[model samples]
Target: MIQSIKITLFDERTLSVRFGDIIIMPSAKVLKNAQYIELGSYQYWPVLVPRGIRLYTYEQVPGFLRENPYITDGYRAYLTSRLCIKSLFILSNETVNIWSHLLGFFLFFTLGVYDLLAVLTRLGASREDYVIYSISLFCFQVCMLCSVGYHLFCCHRSEKTSRRWMALDYAGISIGIIGCYVPGVFYAFYCNNNAAEICSSPKQMAVFVDPLRHSCSPPYDIHTFVWFGYCLQYWRQVYLVTVLAMMLAVFFAQIHPHYLTKKWQKLRSVIFCAVAGYGLIPTFHWIWLSGGFSSDIVQVS
Candidate 1:
């Protein structure tokens, strides 16, 4: 028993044991492969191994790679199928995808905080504008964070955990798309004369509008033309439904086997572009209905 318990230190990264003058180096791979060692009649268990030990192939990596088979097929030239926390910092194919979004999230988060304390607090900017801007920024943050988490942990061995992370990643994208619409609609609806009337009561405003501050009674007028609250609400409801439908489509496309094919992969870019193009309809409508258009509005949209 005493002899079996003898420990030996090898190179800086390795630990071993001396059993009857023979040293056996212990490692994660070794422990996983050989659970125990027999010294005479005594069986000794090795210490637990830390995770993030090595990389694997598409086949070797855990969970169903069917969602994105191309990920491991040299499509992501820099990607390595790494596992655990090590995957977070590694230079895998997802390295850029992960870091870009992570950095973007932090950037937006810092800007959001500054905007609240500086612009909104000082009463220099419209509170409604600030609220709408903040919502967009927050949505971008959620999207980026979700992308980072998905890229980092998608390589996990547990299929269940990986699947949930993937779902969250898709949901974040949906929310972010909706966020992009927030400021656009806000500015369009409240442009010109209606801008001052944005502080309408909650019931008078569109459901999506925050009702941050109550300023004037409805019969909200933009560009000297009167627009009833119900009319505005009807359009807002349509916009909300459209956004929800797009998000559901994105989510279902990711999960459905039919849409997981290589052909669908090529079509995905077109789908995203089409969705983006659809957003332009509102911008054009705003310009037409307001009877005026400006480069500023174009840039915001």
Candidate 2:
């Protein structure tokens, strides 16, 4: 950004000036015919305001962060989308719900890059281990946002509008739920598809261990049996959640109104709650997040 030479107001004297982020240009003179100066790799432009342009702060922030008209529109829209989706917008209640999840998207986008880098570096990246787990997690977050958005906004319109949006919301939940396991299953068992061939019993079918590359599986005599049993129980519940969420989405979205003998308005609360609840099952993220889950942190051995 080049420094402005200052405005000639009363005495027609040029004042030397340097501005960091924002400037008020006199609109009638400089703004009407101002040309952008090209400085090497940058083109500099300034906001021209009417004489005596007064600047006000937004939300207690300083400079262009508040006064830059061009910048605020994007953040405002982001704020609008997020703020409106969560039953906040009487006109578009889904706006806040939609936006909160969208903000979450920025979070996951960072995680995705970490995933690929973890794999290439081999940083002890395991499937269930969490690096590649990001893909599934991100997918579900997006779907949940869409699902919540649809349900929240659908009610704002007419009956036909409500029906369509509700159905779309249900489908989003179904898609998200089904995708939830992909990362865990894929990352946990990606290299061990061959292990499936060595199974001896139906109980042994639970032996989908990745064996930590060079490390031996836990001693199968006792520790292995204990973990296997624990994991089997865990896996069953996890799978059941996916299945149940899917069934509820499809069945409720299509069949519930048939027998409930109530308006869709009556079912709205239950539907939104269930959809939101299914998305919450993935909250184990807090644990993985807290225990140094980062691309920079890796197991040395």
Candidate 3:
């Protein structure tokens, strides 16, 4: 015998389904406002699956969520925090964007554990190396988690919640930039004197002033070495302090009401790009100090 089914909703609370010769009914309390769809049948009983979640098109969503016109469909809208978390399992346009960053968080977190337990241990890494690696990886993980949270919760019913997440996402980007700068600057100028030791040793200073020594007297050579070492250390501090200040400025700027609006989109991009591009200043300086592109350090790096 051929099997067929029909569904009827008598009111907001009553639902009935007729499958072949069998009739099924759900109580008002159980069926009130719940959403579901029938999926063929098993033996004589019809299978029902919950589908309370809804997906919207780009134009149908709110203005803030309409950032991408190219993504024409598959948007979750008007959801509460509970529903937002529930939607993580639902397949939608943001599925990849959300999962990718989530996975990245896990990847970085795993790498951090391995670095501390195995990689750094094998390398006989110092306390400074441990601190740097921890900071860089922690920033990466924070960046990933912030991006995931922003994307996952951007469709929240409250605009304020969405904007807050957006601000956090941008701040995470700045932190990630710091993560890159810390290690790059640290290792790039690893041989140079730190703030505590402006003049490491006469032997190291001699290496720095060796070429100039033949061109000058002993006293002049010593003076030049001290001056050059102090200058290098000074610039290092300046670069780090500048980056920290820029990060703080960006964080404070994000507090502005108009910062996250579409009107300031380009300005936002420009700010981030400028912050990232600032790294080039130290990069070129390092190249110059390493004897231009011909030096072994510059060439290998």
Alpha-carbon RMSD, each predicted model: 11.4, 15.0, 6.1
Error of 1 at 183 (Å): 0.4
Q: Which of 2 and 3 is the better model by lDDT?
A: 3
lDDT of 2 by residue, 72-154 (tens): 22121112223324334232223466657667656666766776576545877554456335546655665666665554444
Error of 1 at 232 (Å): 7.3
Local accuracy of candidate 1 as per-residue lDDT tens digits, 199-285: 354454443243321222332243332343434455655675676577667766655544445667766676667666778877676
TM-score of 1: 0.54
Write down the TM-score of every candidate.
Answer: 0.54, 0.35, 0.74
Clashes of each: 2, 14, 0
Stretches > 4 Å off in candidate 3:
1-51, 192-231, 262-267
TM-score for candidate 3, residues paired by index: 0.74
Clashing pairs in model 3, backbone N/Cα/C closer than 3 A: none
Scored by CA lDDT, what does every candidate get?
Answer: 0.58, 0.43, 0.73
